[model samples]
Target: MFSDILCVILFCTLHFIASSSELQPGMPNVCADQEMSMLGARQPCVQAFTRMVKVWKQGCNSHRWCMGYERRTAYYTVYRQVYNMDTHTVYKCCPGWRQDGKEMGCLHRVCSANTCFNGGQCAETGDKICQCPLGFKGTQCQYDVNECERDEGGCEGFCCNTIGSFYCKCPEGSRLGPDGRVCHDVNECEELNGGCQQTCVDTPGSHHCECNEGFRMHSDGRTCIAVNSCSVLNGGCEHKCVDTGNNNYKCECRKNYQLKRDGRHCEYTRVHCSCRPGFTLAADGKNCEGIEMEIVNSCEKINGGCSHHCEHTTNGPLCSCNHGYQLALDRKTYSDECVSGGACCRHFCRNYPGGYECSCRAGHRLNPDGCGCDDVDECLAETSGCEHDCVNTLGTYECFCELGFRLDQDQHSCIYLLFRKVPQLLQYTAALHSRYVSDEDDSDGGDREVEIQRGRRGELRLSSSIVCLDGSFGDDCSVSCEDCDHGVCSENRDQCECAAGWTGIICNKTCSQGTYGPACNSLCRCQNGGSCDPVTGKCVCPPGVQGLLCEDGCPRGHFGMHCRRKCNCPNNGHCHRLYGGCLCSPGLYGRLCHLCEYQ
Candidate 1:
């Protein structure tokens, strides 16, 4: 029985040991320390503490914890309760081990508690913070992303936000593009041409109506109407325009007019003119008149007989004299009676039945008016007539010979100037006489030869005579002088003698202050402090004077004599009778100042 009791005691002791080995309440399956002794199996405890520190460093909850022993104590207690086991005396866990609700293993380094939503991520930070994705907001990312709030999702037209996404929309006439953000215009005209009658133009959001060629749009802007070409200024016709249907027209000209090349204008076919005698038909053979015809034998007409010679005039005929003749007292008979005593002929005269004929010597001809004679240009007419040179005079021409020759009396021939050296002999004789006189005191032998030469020179010089022509006077017949003012020059002398009231050698000087005219014989008749023009003999009066002489004041209504004048103009007008002009006041005009301009 004692042996049986010993066996039972031993079995009871083994059962107690086995029960102690089993995990108890508040105790982990693996223990780092035994009896809470650091020296016994302290490695497992150190390892477990190190793992807890690591988990705390990572984060105890989705919300970050404060970094302090006091703040971490609560987290440490919770972590210890969640991960370690209680042995009725101490709490412990295995080395490098942790517990996270139904899972026991190594420490989890992340602080994620399913707090973030909609693709958001919870960050392992000191505080509970959610890193939301794009377009998301709020603490736990519970709100949908509002992409439209920021930038309208980069939409071109309109934006619409919905549950973490966005969409773009367009207007009525536009549609969204492939990019889902841009808008494109919808061309309604492209389909059935917008149901237009003629043409339709597509606009940005709508369309418009138009017309085709030669057609205009109606007021409704949809229907097309036929254009009326004739409605525009009668088709731009000069005469009558007739429409020929279908926007076409034709121009019709009036009487005596025809259409021009442009088919729209009209031009007169007949030209009219004033019919008059002596006018011929025009080149166009129309009603116009042309140049006048020439009249002939006008003296044969009635009341057109001329006493001497009949000459045709523009109006009719007239009497005239023949060449080299003059009309008599009857004004019809030509005769030479004027040349007998009237001094009509300049050179020669001849008598005729009805007129007097005047003739000029050779190298002269009658003037155009048949009053005087003029020298003929013989050199120009007959260039070969002279041997060397030709000189013309009043009634004759002279031919000049060369230096060794002379002109003959016939005036057209040249002769040698024989004995030309005779004048040179006189010069030699004087030189010889001077030398003889100078040497006389030294020797008198050369005196006799010099005296003989001097006597011969004097004889030859005396025999030769230098005769001056009729209008010329001088030792060599070379000097000439014109008659004095209004006075004739004497043929024998070259002196100038002025006429009455005239002076100066060349007869060019006029009379003194009180005389004027050809011979300056007229006396001045100026009055009222007036002066005379020396050449014109007209009076120059002072201010306030008029007439031939300045002897009167300005006329009534006339002012400064320089410009202002009197006026008898009507309708409050002014007139300048001196200039035959009239100036009417405002609203009135005309030569007589009787017309109203505005009216």
Candidate 2:
């Protein structure tokens, strides 16, 4: 039944109202009730509806005609007699004029009521009563019987009452039952009188400890102890033992006395000489003097009182290294010169505290800027090596193979080494140089014609120099057309044409998209400009545009579709080109200013 109703509503809204082509002068009503007709005498129906309205309007005036009742269920009937001509026409026209084609349909909803529990309903028989579930009982179901009450065999300990519930508390030293009922003894003596130190006395709900006489209450007020100790002055000093109460104390010697090894005797003795570690026995046996006693100061050593490497001023040993010598690992002086193998690289060599260091070879820099050697990239023009790739290995440079050739290990120059003909020894080197040289080739134009042509399978050459030396043909007398510089390569002369976002002989530097200027430096500068090709960094201009580099912004009120037409919105809607329309601004409607109504 519910499905059928929904289908009817859907059909009315979707087909009848949506499609103007589906309208007809008269059609049979699709309502479930048969009594109601599409066209009926409207007078009697209106009268009945008016009376129904009066009964439902609780606080509304009857004359106002304002609808207050929920039109949940609809009743339709064809009047046999014509009650009023005006009403008849109204009834006939009403169905056709419905905005959604679903007029006069009815629905039913749950009714409102006062009886609720915890914000929920007390339905059916108990209309206005709060219906609480089990374990709950009260006038308003707001309170529960305190099972924990003192009388109802309740909480044997303490009682706590809450809304719709109550809890039990065990006696002072007992625990409440699992069911929250009776209280059980804790047996304070079991856990050592709750950690107490004496006999435990269990009371109704609590317990107390009985400590022996001499013991005072501890912080916990439970433990006991012995009566006397060394803590008490003269309390237990049998042989002059310092009175230490609570079983702890120390024995001290009387005044003018020294404690013996056993901590019992006190005796007075004269001076004795047991010299310290750093000092030695003096010949007199009454005084101690330091060993190795030299009689010179630092100033005296400065004035050359000592020999070659001695500091005789302060009477201490000297501190100096022999000529061309430095301290060895043993801190002993030795004259030594570092040979080529041990000499430091370009950096200066100084006599260090011990040993020596060798600087690295030339064309090399230090690691961490100054600590270790890192071969310099001689290829960098600034560093002044070869004009090309500048690969810096341990100590030397091997001229790299140009774009096409591979470098010869023995000759120190580039050589024509093919993957199929030459050994794999040069493969790694060829790959590196290719990557490095290709980046610079674009700026060096001359080779543009070689890109377009097809060559023998895998027979592509890297440079025209290779071709010149090998005597190959393909016009322009250049080398392999495989990798050309100018944009894309022209098959003829090793030539290439640059693409967008790329420049120089070969497509090297990447140009930013949505930007176009010299060297692709300046952006389009046009606000709301469409993004050009990402690679070439060009701007797609709309029609009727006039400006150098397309940098001028769009004119006011005229936008979209080549900036051809003026914007059209009711009042002032934000014009959106993508949608080909304007979004009416707040308090506006219709295209451009066509409609003048507030939102």
Backbone collision count in every prediction? 15, 59
Residue-level lDDT of model 1, residues 1-599, one tens digit each, is 99999999999999987666444445543454446322222222122133223223336467566343332222122212124434435434443234554333323333356757788777656444677777678867778877887777799888999887778988867889898988899896775345355567999977887875546754334445447655555655668978764334578999999986656567789747544334565766656554656666666774254545866665456666667656555444443454335646666664444555677877667877575665565654775378766543333445666454544434456666444123221111112122123332213443444344323222111112344444443233332363243566755556445565464443546677777665676788886446677667788754345688654544323433543433333322334425525645457667765688878
Q: Write the per-residue lDDT of candidate 2 for residues 298-379, one digit (tens) a residue.
A: 4353434222364542333445565555433433233333422244334444233345543556765555534345555454
Top lDDT prediction, candidate number = 1
- CA displacement after TM-score superposition, residue 44 of candidate 1 (Å): 57
TM-scores for every candidate against the unseen true structure: 0.19, 0.23
Off by over 4 Å in 1: 1-114, 119-121, 124-128, 213-599
TM-score of 2: 0.23
Q: Cα lDDT for residue 138, model 1?
A: 80
Candidate 1's displacement at residue 53, Å, is: 82
